[model samples]
Target chain A: MTSQLEALRRELDRINEEILKWLNRRAEVVQEIGRLKLKQGINRFDPVREREMLDHLVRINTGPFDDQTIRALFKQIFAASLKLQQKQHEDALLV
Target chain B: MTSQLEALRRELDRINEEILKWLNRRAEVVQEIGRLKLKQGINRFDPVREREMLDHLVRINTGPFDDQTIRALFKQIFAASLKLQQKQHEDALLV
Candidate 1:
């Protein structure tokens, strides 16, 4: 029983680590998108793209959480990516 | 050594769960703030409050990541919470 519990705990740890790794990768890609938006002089907040991404995630999601929650999570993610890009822009100006 | 590792892993998992619970609580407050803003006819984006939160988070952060990263993370979180509030507003309007 102890060993079984150990195995399950390890599995959860592995999954959590994988989730964080994927989140980092997602942040990197979003940063790239922010750079593209900056280069094109487009608004950081793109409702159309955001809506599409949320819709896609909602359609594909089958999980412990609901679609709205997932969409809300992603929306926060995009906002954070945009802020990072903006910070980079400010740093470049200061330099 | 395996037992020690198991203990550490369980600790991290517990921390992760606590973090998620706190996030939910934060979202609830943000929702309340959103409704108040609507009632008083205020903007959703409050630069002063946001800047203050980020600054506080950065000041309090002590970790593997830098202050900027911490601030960036919180900014994303606030954005997500705001999005949830906005969605709630829209739902109310639709009904």
Candidate 2:
């Protein structure tokens, strides 16, 4: 039998891969949003929508991780996506 | 034709679901690690390993998100996981 730590590590590796895939998918959506926002002359950041999302996540969290940490993680995700969107917009401007 | 924003929002919704799934999976693994650590009398927090992970992430990141933000996000993840492990250990001790 595999050691418990080894098994757990394997699971973590699998989940990390899945997270990477989802992050990339999210980035693609952010790029699309950036394009649309540029066309509409809209700001990329939407604090109200982000707050709504965090609230939703808080409601649904049945966690080993607490609310504050969950919020922090989601905020990082949002910040990363926003940065990705901004980069896409800048690249489009240059092209 | 679907408005670009609406289509992008749909994609974001799909990706968010995937990300949520992966996060939960990661949490499960973290709990397992907690159990193993408790049994082995090992500390849950491993700063060196975490640093190695952040370094790997930095090397692999091709991002609009800078290295500092990536490291920060990973630190949050590590902290959350460490907390989860501690909680598990406490619960098991009480059982």
Candidate 3:
């Protein structure tokens, strides 16, 4: 019983670490996109691209959660990413 | 010792429930705002309002985490809310 609990604990820890790593990776990508947008004088908020991304997520969703739930999750992820991009842009202006 | 652990467990559980409830509240407000935005034909992505929210968050931040991290988390929450708005709009359109 102790071994089983330890194994589950270790699995949860591993998953938590992976989530952190992925979030870090996501911020990095957002920063790159920020640079590109700045260079191109493009708006950070691309409605068409966002709509397309949501549609793709729905198409690929093999869910334990429903489509609306997945869409909500992805939307939150994108919003965070947009903020990262905005922050990077502000930092560039300050420099 | 067991009692202390149990108390801590209950506190965490209560925190979890509150977080979920707050999220639901956020979603409800987002829906109301969505209706307003749709009526006005305003873009859902309002940079000025978002910037104000982020600035207010930063001002109030007495942090265990840094400003950027907190901003990122809030940004994710905002993005999720936008997705909910989009879904609701689509449903209205279909009906």
lDDT of 2 at A9: 74
Every candidate's lDDT: 0.55, 0.74, 0.59
* Candidate 2 local lDDT, B34-76, one digit each (tens): 7777778787777886787678767776654566766776677
* Higher-scoring candidate on TM-score, 2 or 3: 2
Q: Select the stronger candidate by TM-score from 1 and 2.
A: 2
Which candidate achieves the best lDDT against the true structure?
2
lDDT comparing candidate 3 with the true structure: 0.59
As a whole number from 0 to 100, the lDDT of residue B30 in candidate 2 is: 86
Q: For each prediction, how big is the interface RMSD?
A: 12.7, 2.1, 15.5
Winning model by DockQ? 2
Ranking the candidates on DockQ from highest down gives 2, 1, 3
For residues A1-95, could you state the per-residue lDDT of candidate 3 as single tens digits? Answer: 24543453344333333333344455555566557668767676777867776786566554433467656755765676677677778989999
TM-score of chain B, candidates 1 onward in order? 0.87, 0.90, 0.88
Total clashing pairs for each candidate: 0, 0, 1
CAPRI classification of candidate 1: incorrect
